[model samples]
Target chain A: MAAGGRWRQTLVGFLCLVLPLVSLWYHGRARPTPTLVERGLMRLTSPAQHAMSGVVASLSRVFTDYVWLVGVVEENRDIRRQNEVLAGLVQDREQLRKENRRLKELLRFKGERPELQTLAAQVIAKDVSPFHRVLKVALSAGADDGLERFQPVITPAGVVGHVERALGRYAEVKLAVDSDSRIATAAVGRDVKGTLVGSGDRGDFLATFETLGEAVAPGEEQRPLEAGDMLVTSGEDERYPKGLVVGHIGEGPARQSDLGWVYPVVPSVNFRTLDLVQIVTDHISTAPLDVPR
Target chain B: MSALGQSLSVILITFFLLGVESPLLQELHVSSFPPDLALVPVLWLALHVPPATGMVASLVIGLIKDGFVMGVPVGMYAEISVVTFLVARFLTSKVPIRGLSSLMITTMLLSVLASMLLALLSLLFDPAFQGHGTVLRLAGPVALVSAPFAPLVFFVLDRTDSLFARSRQRDAIFGR
Candidate 1:
């Protein structure tokens, strides 16, 4: 019995040291992929996570619906007042609609992007690490739902992240504000282009743009990038489509890096309140842009 | 309690805590930092359980957490948690920790150490991990947040242990 116990102790000790080292080595490699064990574990745990999220969401809905009903009377009165005002604006709205249709016809505008295929998904869970921020969010849809890894997630506001991993009925999205996340972006209607990387602070989903190109020549006059400058996807990497709203630039003390220039940007999407998002599944190719490489 | 019973209880508690930490506790973010409720139970297990059991419990809890949380490597939290459990176990054995104050102090130190280990490991393994600045900013608040909950966690776990003990005694006396 004593000998058996000693051997078991030795085995356990060996495993304790070996398991973590193996995991570290596997995860440390560039473009690390989840192992079979990881996938199995994800498959096993996803249902539980889904169930927990469902319960919490249900409770929140119940509480909000029942507790906040007291304001319904006042809200109804306010809605009635708003309805009266809206009635007066119906004629103006009809006129504007006619004008908008005429303008669209003149410009030969297609209703929406026919090339891009998108599917809507709901966020199920978020990262708990306060220090790391919400580097990832769990989504309700997964491989079974036509979600694929590296597919970009977005909202009406702007870019959210890409699908990092897709299991049976669940997927993990690597949020745009994660320290590891990078997106190719450019200033709208400007020559400025850079890669946006997350600034790992919580409640502050600010990203810093690492500009690409030669520095401004000494004593050469150059227009400075300013706050509220709209940013859009450059499609240089071919990951995200061009002209998708990325974010707006924020004013900060000018900083320079070997990359060229760095500026802070406020992401267009408010990550904190992300309930629903769209995943870009496929897009038809268009004519490529000429580049001076 | 039987060993199996204790292990099951620990596993159940850890799972529930994992659920709470991610989706539930995250919603109650106070001042940008939510208390790591999972760590509280981990500390309790390490301090109160036998060495082998504690180690197993720590690994199980850590792996479960890794699966649910994102951005970090799979073994990062598990490794840190195992180290924390070992250190806590060693210290408790060497020095008798009495009173709620001492326990709370120990909890704070362990929390800080765990956070630092996480930061260090990220720096070593994750190429995208920036630096120790985020860890430094969060360590104090996380430790402070976890400290107040130590006593509560300890009390609940202690009660659980006692309940199991009592039931076992009753079973033995009844000779089922």
Candidate 2:
């Protein structure tokens, strides 16, 4: 090999080693203080990332809209059938409306608590590694939009996850199904409370609930939690507010011998279809005087 | 084909793959185990191009991947790609992959190695990354899905190179 070629090869090989070591060192840092290099790279790459994502979003919208229109006729037929069924329930709908009004009035009797503050954000991208089961979803909202790390992200149905990383104009949310995610939850109107942990299986949205009690005593049995029971946030940790729906019990309360009972919970929010989500910013207390505990 | 042409083609292919991954693959609802299409070009370049060119292409593609795709540590994928490129370059030079079966096996082996390296890096660097066992379980499936694309990508890249060569020859003949 010529001297110049050999020198170049040596330099490239040295870089091949140094770069990965630098990356590993950066990764090992607890709170990676973004150096000038990272900051500059982020600034340069952020715009390109946003533009690429936007272009992809536009193309997908066009494809889905145009291609999916072909099924409109079949969809219309199904809608007509559903409309006929709905027509027969018109009277029932009226009765239900009256009952709903009464229930709304009764709920109003408890007054409003004003502590909860929320901001809506649109999901722009999702990063799922082929090797790892964890999902990190990026949103349009960021630090400038009052999105902070550890804030709970939710859909109308239930919790999605917490903010994992908040950047200048973008943030990454760690999905609830990620194995590292843990939520404090309880069975609604039941004494059962547990820490719900994600199972890390993509096919299964069911989280495992590890109960906070001793195993059933010898000769004495605990009431097994049945399927279809609602689980809600206990708010004991103050990370999430009380009374928000979490998920529904799926199969168990099966004894784990040493670890009390364990249950599978089907999350209320379907993460596959998530688009728009709200970030909980603050909690306000809304307790009214003379309300019975 | 000229070196510049090859480099441009590689960059274009990498960008196209990134664009497809963001919304198209996710829309297809394969976010859980999306196949690594970008690796096809890296492997192809390593097998066909000069070592220096292949290494440079691998590093560039890896940087693009880290910046654009799943937000991994900056140099993580770059290192993996370079390592894979070097290995593929070495193996092809020594053993000479002869048939489709051998090519497929080579791609699968390289994919598995890349997946394992990525998992190890994630475990070491990504503090929030959990499920070391999950990575082990997924390596095979990821390799399996990625392997089929190798032949198709190689064919396309080969065609592009031939077309570039023909164009250059035509320009030379016409004295343009």
TM-score of chain B of each: 0.85, 0.85
Report the lDDT tens digits of candidate 2 across residue range A26-69: 75454524445444555555555566767876776556444444
- Candidate 2, superposed: residue stretches over 4 Å from native: A28-114, A130-144, A214-224, A236-238, A252-260, A285-293, B1-5, B68-72, B97-102, B159-176
Residue A292 lDDT (model 2): 19
Candidate 1: the clashing residue pairs are none
Interface RMSD of 2: 3.0
Per residue, candidate 1 scores C-alpha lDDT tens digits across B44-83 of 7665566667667777777777776666667877787778
lDDT of 2: 0.67
- C-alpha lDDT of residue A59 in model 2: 77
TM-score of each: 0.82, 0.76
Across residues B1-176, which tens digit of lDDT does each residue of candidate 2 receive? 76656867976777667655756667677777767777878877776566677777788777777655543657777788888888888877787766566777888888888888878877777776666677778889988877877777667666766667765542110122
Mark the 10 consecutive residues where model 2 chain A has the least summed lDDT.
Answer: A284-293
Specify the highest-TM-score model's number: 1
Clashing pairs in 2: A113-A286, A115-A283, A115-A284, A116-A284
